[model samples]
Target chain A: MTLNRRAFIGTGAAMAAALAAPAVRASNHGKPRVIVIGGGAGGATAARYIAKDSKGEIDVTLIEPTRMYYTCFFSNLYIGGFRDLSSIGHSYGTLAQSGVNVAHDWATGVDREARTVTLAGGAVLPYDRLILSPGIDFVEDSVSGWDVSAQNKMPHAYKAGSQSELLKAQVEAMPEGGRFAMVAPPNPYRCPPGPYERISMVAHLLKEKNPTAKILLVDPKEKFSKQALFEEGWNRHYAGMIERIGPDFGGDNVSVNPDEMTVDIDGVVEKVDVCNVIPAQKAGRICEMAGITEGNWAPVIPHTMQSRVDENIHVLGDASNQGDMPKSGFSANSQAKVAAMAVRGALLGSNVFPAKFSNTCWSLIEENDGVKVGASYEATDEKIVSVSSFISQTGEDADLRKQTYEESIGWYSGIVSDMFG
Target chain B: MNWKHDRFWGVLATVAGVGLATPVVAEQQDARIGDAEAGKEVYDLCVGCHEVGPDAGNGIGPHLNGIFGRRAGSVEGFRYSKGLSREGRLGMDWTLETLDAYLENPKALVSDTRMSFDGLEDKADRDNVLAYLRQFSDSPQNIPESAPTGRAREVGLSQETLAIAGDPEFGEYLSNECTTCHRIDGTYDGIPGIVGWPEEDFVIAMHAYKRKIRPHPVMQMMAGRLSDEEIAALAAYFGDLE
Candidate 1:
């Protein structure tokens, strides 16, 4: 069987690799093309790795709607006045300069049969491999009487950028001694410690600007990540400033009225000055458009992050249902490297090592008080399983806490560079 | 390194201290001498600057928690005088003998110590104060039956592992886990730089963390799972970064 360029495009990669000569790519079939959608932690890292490691052997194109990406990891610090908004925002200029063809447009549709993606700008991109790391989107009507349109009245600063700025402005402009309410999301959300961290930042802000201002946290889960650490910090730093209602207190049965600026928790409606309603989450709409999601997320093989339904596409970050690892920027960045390696090995026959995964989350409770939780993981046939883990002890010295906070600053710089460059 | 010699001295001091106590010697052979109850009264004089306890924080002087087994003038966030900093640089650790000597004559030990205290003329007073200070420090020699502190290197490397030839290409791939917090550019922004380190030093440091010798919890957890070959690979990769 003669392996021509036309036949190479039609056949599966595995079959062609076994039959065709290695020089076939250089002689006739041009570089294997990879189209990575969503230029955030997962997509950016994957695209950059494939482009850089392949050494011009593979054509990589990154499709993302936002040119300046605002990282959600440090947006809470901005809310607490520890960082400037500009510091957390990054541009894709560096990535574009380094081999990757940056496409500033939204992905509208995916045709798995034709192996092509349609953009909102009416451009169709064909690829031998596709990576979808679209992060997360709020589930439609996940919270009663709330939708994306109501975001202006009740900001869900989960995605960062302008929403974060607006939320900060709203919090700052609240009436003296006003009430701030947060409707937290359920289990299996992006950044397991995010909502609690945001609360800490809000409490930090209130302590400075309005000491009498109170925070009401309504959470659906019975317990949360780093609950003991957060509780201890809250007691020490922001005593009487914050109150949390867990599942036992009808927190799961929550509804909000953005127009009325009120929240209904178990038939008790409370007026609030600013409401942060973080609704339940699902994989980005692009994953659903590609018809790869199961239930609310795209399930992928832990080893390669390849979609269970389609071998041509790999899902990453918050969109991927890779077991054990949380939905975080750090987790996404880690998974992206593994996926990038697998993609290169599949497309260009590069060395693919056994997949190793790890993640750590640091949350600031006050000025110099920080806590963290982390775990190292390895891929088994069943799932990515945690083998070793650690978390900050409740009563640590101020020096260690301050060191942790500084380390987080360094991590912010390190990760943004890792993702963008 | 005189680590073994230092341990012997620590054990000897503990034994000598045990001879002075009657009932306390039954609980631990390394128990310090002097009345801790009476030393509480002696601590009143040092309370103007020094602090000790759960919520103890740095005042004019550094907080005294975990002072045992710690190097002199090495507390974070405190600006040590030139004399104490030099003593710490010269490897002056605060053990039973060192602390007692410093307490006996601050000026004689560290010529330019910022501490403005006269020498304790009474031997009994110095003994009591040293015992009271020892209560705040957790010496591994004093508490051998307690859970092994994460600061001890419990695991040792096999000669075979120490001799493994690392693959640099594999090292680059494995380094992704480290570059999350450590800058590949070698910038030390709160986190220490790892790029361009000597391979041997890198391997030794990682193994120390792997063995739970390092104090950082995150580093311990990260290094705990890495195989010997993986550590060697990372060392090789980071060594060649420059």
Candidate 2:
């Protein structure tokens, strides 16, 4: 088990489509219906927790496009060859076993006032409570010349799975001394430490396979999560191998010409053997379609994860504009537990505990060099804020780092079991 | 210049978790203990096996309601390990000192116990967990007087690790595991609470648990895991809470 955030986001809810439909399960048990629009970390966990805890009291229906989910958290380890792709992928069979009506279909439209969801398969499902944990989506036109059409050429392995495979193949195929470039995303994105970890993983691969090869990081932000630790790791493990250009050096204003296989940074174009263009991210499009979003993300009450505009809907994970919490799988899972408790209390009249949340973000710099940052949070009148926090220092010993890495493995196993089983 | 050794030095100076090795001889500052709030967080690790509170029941492990002062191996339907049953025959109660010893090394205290957990390593963690445990009991066991002020005051229970009084808020998070056996709001089945006791009482009980004076294998193993700082923090949290 490794670290990765797996988002369960609805496909295209709010965009009505006409296709031959299968009859979606209606509320059969006279129980309140919970229609979860995604089956990844947040959605699946909420569905599982609510359904299992309710003991057949509430009906849970999970709609997801893919039967298998590839976690975005540890997909970097796959590229670094620490794990296989199969290990990062999970199925929804476990959720179904827990009595979740796992529906494999696209969520095309939503009638919020009507409290109904239209599926691409021509099914209209009604709900008493809708939990929308649609993961992130690239903000359209945020990066010039790098659209969905150009994904194959400049893969944003940020989504995991096939994209991860593609990027790995490209890295493996890079000619000796060839240049590899990355177009990093802006702040407040999924997994703040993600790109830097990817950089470390790539550097690990290149160091072993192609020592002479170089990596160029064009980062929009001047600083990043675990900057000091990452810098130290890079210097120790891959010194003189990776170079980063920050905002002051025009790293923010950048574009990739897929047609020419070049990254134009500050009026300078650099042709590379491979390129990773991670565009700006936003709340899942379904959130915007449901009219729950203010700018790019849906806002929710911290304690319950309920939408500010509509209490019937709850948003979690990357789609929700939660203060001080990262948009990672751990965060999503924690939020889901809180939401599940609140939802159970609302629907089943169960006792609801005051919302308390905690999250830890772990990143591997090398094989056994792992660093972590975590905090416990409480929902205040204004927002979810940190109560206490801890981080790995710059000059930790191998034994401690090894222990930290082991702790992450334990967390991964614990979370994966919690989410899927 | 040595990357690996620098990390080694960093570990010695770690601010959180079990032991640290920075020798500081400053002013005699008041020793604040673990936050019950933070102990709640650390208790998350134990949730999978144990259950606490009124709704709590026997899961993978026995329900930990009314644990302190309750006889060992006496959770009615729960099958106690041979060592625990033997200790129960000896009429052992869960004193804080005994709990500290048992948590520090469960297997060493009670061999062949059914529990699969590794004990806490930080003294603060053990003390905080014990404090968190105390929150569920109406009448916790009496605190031992004139106990050796735990090396935990400045150093961890372990010889190599240094200890610090942790934030109870964080301890609350760490105590997620403890809630599997002991609930936070003073509800109990087989376990007990320290929620309303003074911090000093909680600390003495934990030292008893750690020294194996009380002979429950589960407590021995669980106590073994925590450092002095963690125990101190737990005391502050559970003792200060209402």
Candidate 3:
């Protein structure tokens, strides 16, 4: 029905207005938006899984400071003079490919009531569901004389990267027969076996370069990760090179003198050429600010990885207090999946399935030798508890060790692919 | 007048037929229980731990060879908690009613029981497990002969089946991952070497990871990536090495 110019304009405007009305309604329709903070193992995996599985029903956004993450899992190999940092680093390009809106910014604060995450760049990203996996924060005040400035002299290579490099350099540059002291923090920390693993890697390096060098491990606890295996290996391979001090042997009590580069144990001040002070850690600052952290870690429901304090928010990875589960990359990744499912279910109004989680940590004693510990967990009440667990028995045969070493490598590739590709 | 009388007689006959059917339906409902033949199908989940054969050794829990007449904690070689042993000394035997109750709610029946199981919630499931338990006794009743086969063989292969198979190429790729908590040459604490260990032991260890019987969080996450076939291959590859 051809008509005059005024009549045609009026019809076109009416049709356009009708189309625009639905666009406005669509923005406020269907499922809720989920904003994930951090792009490490937990955060990245949650974002990818949620975005991909939501089938465009839920909006997902990931806020991370960096585009690439150098994993702390294999960072020790780099410190031990075996692998480079590039080999362990992963990028978030695959996450972007999964249709997650990756925002390159640090999450400064979260508005729990409003359900919005405030970024460092002053952007308030709104979310119906929020998942936080920002990892750990070191307790600077726990050490008597150690602060931010002292980190340069006595590096805590707990978080990997430059700190790991610094520690490696210190070990490399030490004089022959130099005393290397490692002050391990108390229990309930990230990577329960990490400090012990570091000692093994460092001892491996020392045996080749400085045979007479002394590696003194000052731990707060008497027994440590894979206690039997480490003792067997030390006595057999690094005889007289490593001395471990537990609480019974005056290792638990530590007073650091950062200015002097010295640590005192049981009133005995020992000056060292190299010192690695791993301070006590807590949930990342964001968790503390959100009031999710009870003491140093966030308490979460194991089945869903949902925050106990706020049901709308879910916490995962090293930041969470999942009892009996050590803070490791694998645990973080596993938790991310549980969190993803819960977030998806909550947003879509679907049934939340019970979550079963598994974690494995492989530590290299030397170049090819490896040992591991693993567990499976299920959520009970409000916390994750171990349903089953395994420790590699003492005196493993050569084939088992060799195969385990191989399995460890395969796991790394698989997990990195699963998390970030 | 003849047609109206015929329709009324037909309606009265239909009412009498429905009235007679109610009592027959009630009798059928009462006859469903005590069917041992039907109970065998419900007992599958229990056979993994409790075995009936003479050659069957302890598989984490005690053998059920004479469980019906035996006291709860009298089984030797199997560690029983003081609570269970004390209860055993008091002369506790497995009766049908007690067994039914215990099987229905193990933790409630015996608090702090180390069974690690939340009892069978379904009445039919509890009845079947009880029926299956009864088959192992000296007095065999009308138990079904068609119990599922291959359960014992499958239980034995649980660990072997769970290990990750080693591929040297994949192994080399995985070596970097192992360095986080394991050592190849030097040992510091309790971390073991992985260079030349037996594949069978490695496989068992990996199975432990999958089963969550191992206590480490790190290994649990790492083990989650492996498939059952991949675990076997990894185990075979590792077990074959020197």
Candidate 4:
């Protein structure tokens, strides 16, 4: 069928109002509670969108154990000492201003049948719809001898708060000519190109401080996200400072000893002054309890972001299975919009418009040079498929790189405004 | 008198049933060619190449007037590659059904056409464009003022000399091989440099094909075959020169 432009716009507006009216009526009926778990990019955006779109109709109870969220997007800059932690770490005061009830409590369990959330404090909050965006829980067993305590010596820095700070501290304190090892995760992980980007940023930092210092990357996959661009950037900017270990070069297997800050590889134990191990991940605990997560991640219908297991609950961001879309801040934000639109359709008895999602990930290769890859996606029955994709080609014009770097910052601001403002 | 009254009552009931069904039947028959007027606006992007008029020069594309019945790559003063002429022999035509399938997904229909436009995603737009094209030249009486020479003679080459590697009988065999990725009709994308391409250019391109130069992997493989003489004969056969 053809979608008439006028009809689409009218339906969108009507759906918005339809979503708003119930929450409005419910507010007068003493507020339909909305308890959002996690305060990362996905959870925060979902909470903000629900609060704003519902027009104060929703009493949004955001349950995040952390007082502030430090974005993983810009954590590389913090690691490089280009920016401070305060810059990336954001508070919920802005959410609070939008009439969200921010609670510093972890969600212990979800009573999905009763539609109530059991917080750590023994207080039960009832919700008309529970949005679970609790980000990811790293698989500790993937790497031998790696556990919570082991992270004290060798930080994962996968989540961008204390781990990030500790990783940065270790990098700063490393002696000259020391070795820094970063273990890369396999495919279908959050920020597919993030580990490589992190390596680039760290190499950039290490070049001036300790010229002899080396950054060794061990990866299971032969090819990585944006392989051409990353190799070109590494060769041009940080020549000889970076060594990549692909599966072809016997880099597939990884065994780490977190306490020793060493990784054993193919009968050789390489001790490093600093180590960053990004473990395998799965959907958060809430999704497991809600029965939405199949094994590790939630299976969602691409068109609606509705859970395949339960239609009443919709999953968004990193939790939902959006094929070919890396778990990233930009992707999470895009998924949130789709989820918001679907939520409006479910509540208003209106048709959900077929959505088109697009995302771009920018990696800083040096202080000035950056690489980007992006794609537009459409939903099918099974998964979200790429309609059009583009990458900043190797040896791109200097002006284009500068323009893209600026575009990345602008996109970041625009997306943040669209979500929280 | 009672029997006559019963007959009259039965006749009235039959008429009433027919009357009730009349609008529904008519509605089914008169289905709106689904908003062709809306489709006209969407057709703006397509008019650049497919326009029909006396002033329209066969640019990189053929004049699309009376395209439905026309033999593939038969346009005069325009050159077609071997892929198109081969396809024409396979009884391919620009039928409405074929056009609909082509417009929805071009590459899926013809893997090696060069038209860069992605398929129109909206189904209604496809229907509208199809109707619009039908309105232009469905009848031979409305055909544009263009005469068709024999398909072989149009490209300025004779078929006998061109049939060096494969016979004219083998043209069907070669054509079968071509239709795997090429379209006889002009509706396919990526296969564009197919119809109306220069004969000499085709021969040179095939013989000179190299890895990574042709952009598509299959073309590179196909081009790797055939001696230079065979390439010329195939080019001549496709140029429809006889």
Candidate 5:
């Protein structure tokens, strides 16, 4: 009567009978339980869908440290002045009202064998299924001379809350005509186009606020997400204000001194007014504690999103080594639904459908000038693979770009509603 | 995704004889119910290219035996048009509503169906022909003498046939993809409100996107993957929203 993954996947009647068995009766009285760690795009969507769709049949608990979730997707817009900080923040109240037991606390550790998660508040909760969508965490010491202790001096602003506000304040506080330097992360990080988009927003702000300020971008990668389109926009709008040093030109060899406010590229050292350091990222530490991650990420079964090491645990979003899809909010949201369906089918004996995933990423270069890239994905035996894709073309009409920008606004409203509500 | 569930229920009802058909059909009231005796005469239009019943096999078109709940273009050894094969890959299925649409206008459904017969304009004739064909199929709504048989891929669809009653349960699952970018609360910001549109308009607009007649790339990509039945389901789900 263990009701392991094998019993959960048995025929509907057998699974139903197992749920009715007395030995497995829980505090909720025989209802299957799911515990979700992290409450961003992936975790929030997964928790809400399971609770919303199960109709009180299953108990769902969402453990997130923040009561108000600030999305990283539109934080750049806040930096650029297109949106306010309040506009990008959402609360778990709606999800709680809709049946998810929202627990606002940090998940400190996971015990896979006992199927329990320990919170920072010293409460231990058990689960029939565990979903880890904790997003990205920086690889400590990956960047020389920089660590979390140095964050106050040089903000990463990658997590999108206080750090975003801090970054914006720093940019606004820069001295006239001062230099702004960004140490961009290497390949395999969150949001493929994020660093470039931030640069666009930063440039937009400087053009209006401090016209003569200089921007120095040091990249470890040879090329980035939307290189041609970004290059085209940068040249068109901020022609002489920005400079980039790619890996071919010693950009890969970089170090920053937060105390001195200087950057060393290969051997040359230069002083800068502000520094944004985005280090290499890995799956959040909870995945490592659960012993599910391989190297930097947790590998999952493409169809169910279940961790390869343990069937009862599912890894999602920026944390999972899913193929072809970018590490964006949209991809995580899409993956959440598939994982929710699989969990419901396993627990509630409900029908399961094939996994269909899609993602679209939009970046605004300047006022009313936005571009996008998107693709549709299907789960194959080995991994989720792209089936079809589309991207915005260069030199498009202003009207089209405006429409794309407006469309992105609509998308933000839509995705936030999908996540929070 | 829709067809897999349908096929699962179809197999369960056929093999277990477990009285699962009534609930399935009750949930989908628009499925296979008409005067089969009258449908026999209306099916004469299809006699030239298609055949059904015990001795039925591939003809000018694939045989219609066990057509209900069957995947489109999936008959073994029968060469199908590229358009129909593509639809099959896109997850098209042969269900009661889809059959009626195909009977009403073959080109409207597949856009390139090889059958050149003029469409039946009367809804009664289409319904009766589908009811007549239902006798040869193995849905829970009908107890055919032979077993249910067909390969399934995925997808659901329809054409200009406006009377389709989509299964909202299936729509709820598919709507997850839509709610990501389109608010379920019907709030319009940069994206238009899709809630409460007439089912007919919803179906037509989605078909236009599927055909690339619509201008938006994201919409075209989303609609292109949906089958006729899936379109009908979304229309039903959104049309009824408050």
Candidate 6:
């Protein structure tokens, strides 16, 4: 109540309100249609910002498969009980209210030459510019004995919602002293810190319900983002409960047997109570189908996010092969602003400033115990380069950790508002 | 002044009630007081870690509600770093000078702060951001000696007495140059929609470029050619847009 009261008397609208959602206009017949595929952080923000800033000058439509979009950013926190699934879920009502056409449909194909996106319903939506922010999709055959068919039993849970629920259920159902094995994905995956955060969360849940349970992380990469901080957290709270096998120790050579729920690390096979097999990932199917893939991801100019293959299309979030930025929701949100600005400028001729981007990734090791790594970036000719960066140090005091946790909470709220609204 | 403009004075009245009128220096700023409207844009740099609304809880940095002259590191529910706490105990109130210094380089000022921001380097940008923060300040603090004073009666009556006032009609007449770059209907070359902006913001931005506080050489060259009234007129015309 105090928070609401405080907000009521506070100065003008918050930054989220001030920046996007312009009051300009044009009729559909004359207005340029901007189609955004995906309703996650990147898509929603881009759609809202374009529509708002244009004030009806540019027509904007958002195509998403689901009406209730659950964010992948804090899904790990949900597994660890820091948040409920509903809290991380967002709807398109605000975007619709702000004058965006929110269409719930799968984008089946992009007729690049025709400049139209054909939806699953067979309706073709024309656009002056198309923004593809389809989040990552797991590489089908990247890991042996692991595929989408076995996802229900040995869940990847990367996309959030049902998969996340399944993984959390599996972690919860584990017996005391049981082995919970996680086959972490390789580099160029969505949310670089995500797998480790999931590990920390599962460890927290296990420590509470099954204290002696072991967390076995089979990591393909030799080093990970925030490695020191995560290592410190595991030592401090979940000490002796987690062990990581990096590439040097055959972490790269791993296979899963879903029927038996066993993970074979190199030549050694280990039976596990629960298995989370996160495979190598690539841009979503639609991105590949659209023919934007240079390989696993679409290439885009770092400044405008315009696809290198086609200037009319912009690829954002994990799907983009922009330099130096992680494929995280935070990064998506940051990139969306730049793309939105560029898109609007291209279509409506809105005043545009230089592209500026920032990202912060937070991981919760325990309740009220969190750490973060973040950076400020500028778009250079070669790539988006980091200008300044900071990371939480190992063994930080409780107050700082608590502060970091609180900050994550604040960032979550602010970013969600910036995206959904 | 119109009823819309009166709202600022009304908000200031509440602040002035508990406000301290300490003599201030524009030591870190220029002759012109920065505009809060433009400052909001610059605040984008700090948005990564700090939260700025009244509803904002402590983020990585403290929620900066009513931060001006608020005791350093004294926001309720926030855990201040040890170095920051010492600054508070040593009686460091968040004055314009303190804020300017902190924004210049947080590490140098606090030495042991746990904040992740590298700090905002430009002084003019800092002044603009501070102006933005001053709006939410529950109680007013310093009064810059250089700022307009004793113009209360004139403030609500004539544009001449207003600090950043402009005549929209005159601005419209002189807006030919703006048209080539910024189209009247909010459509132009990769340029943004300058229409419907607050006059104060437009003035501050032009001043930022004219003063070379910001980095755009083209903007600096263009802004350098204008007089204060001409800039104000242009702002008024553009502000009247949308």
lDDT of 4 by residue, A219-331 (tens): 87666767778899999888898988877766777788876778887657899999998877778778888777887899876655667776556677777775546677877
Question: lDDT tens string, model 4, B1-242?
Answer: 22222232232222222222111110011112334566678778787766664455576667676565467667788776555555667766665556677789866655555555699988778867765555444321111111110000011112333332345423322332243224433233323325444679987777566333664233443454334554565576666732
Q: Pick the candidate with the highest lDDT.
A: 5
User: Distance from true position, residue B226, model 6, in Å?
Assistant: 24
Q: After superposing candidate 5, which stretches have Cα over 4 Å from the reference?
A: A1-28, B1-166
Which one wins by DockQ: 1 or 6? 1
Q: What does each candidate score in C-alpha RMSD?
A: 18.8, 22.2, 19.0, 23.0, 15.1, 17.9
Q: How high is the DockQ of candidate 2?
A: 0.02
Scoring the B chain of model 2 against the true B chain gives a TM-score of: 0.46
In order, the Cα lDDT scores of the candidates are 0.79, 0.71, 0.66, 0.63, 0.80, 0.73
TM-score of each: 0.73, 0.63, 0.63, 0.61, 0.74, 0.62
Q: Please, what are the lDDT tens digits per residue for candidate 5 over residues A242-340?
A: 999999899999999999999999999999999999999999999999999999989987767888888788898999987667888999999999899
Give the higher-TM-score candidate: 2 or 6.
2
Whichever of 1 and 3 has more DockQ, that candidate is: 1
> lDDT per residue, candidate 6, B79-165, as tens digits?
889999999999998866788788889998899999777888776688678767755653110111111200111113124223323
Residue A198 in candidate 1, Cα distance off native in Å? 0.6
Better of 1 and 6 by TM-score: 1
Q: Residue-wise lDDT of candidate 3 within A46-136, one digit each (tens)?
A: 8877887677777788898876687888788888877888888777777888888889888888888777789999998777778999988
lDDT tens digits, residue span B1-242, model 1: 22332332232223222222111111111112455567789999999999998789999999998786589999999999999999999999886567778888999999999999998888678767765776675422112111112111112233332332243566787798888889889988888899999999999999999788987888997888676767888888998897
Model 6, residue B93: what's the lDDT?
Answer: 84
Q: Which candidate is the best by TM-score?
A: 5
TM-score of 3: 0.63
Where model 4 places Cα greater than 4 Å from the true spot, the runs are A1-31, A348-351, B1-242
Q: lDDT per residue, candidate 1, A280-355, as tens digits?
A: 9999999999999999999987767888888789999999887667889998999999899877776766555556
Q: Is candidate 3 or candidate 6 better by DockQ?
A: 3
lDDT of 2 by residue, B1-242 (tens): 12222232223224112222233222211112233455677778878988887778888888876676577788988887898999888987765667777788788777887787788888778766765665554320011111111112222233222222343543443343343234455643334544666878877777777787875333443454455566676777776667
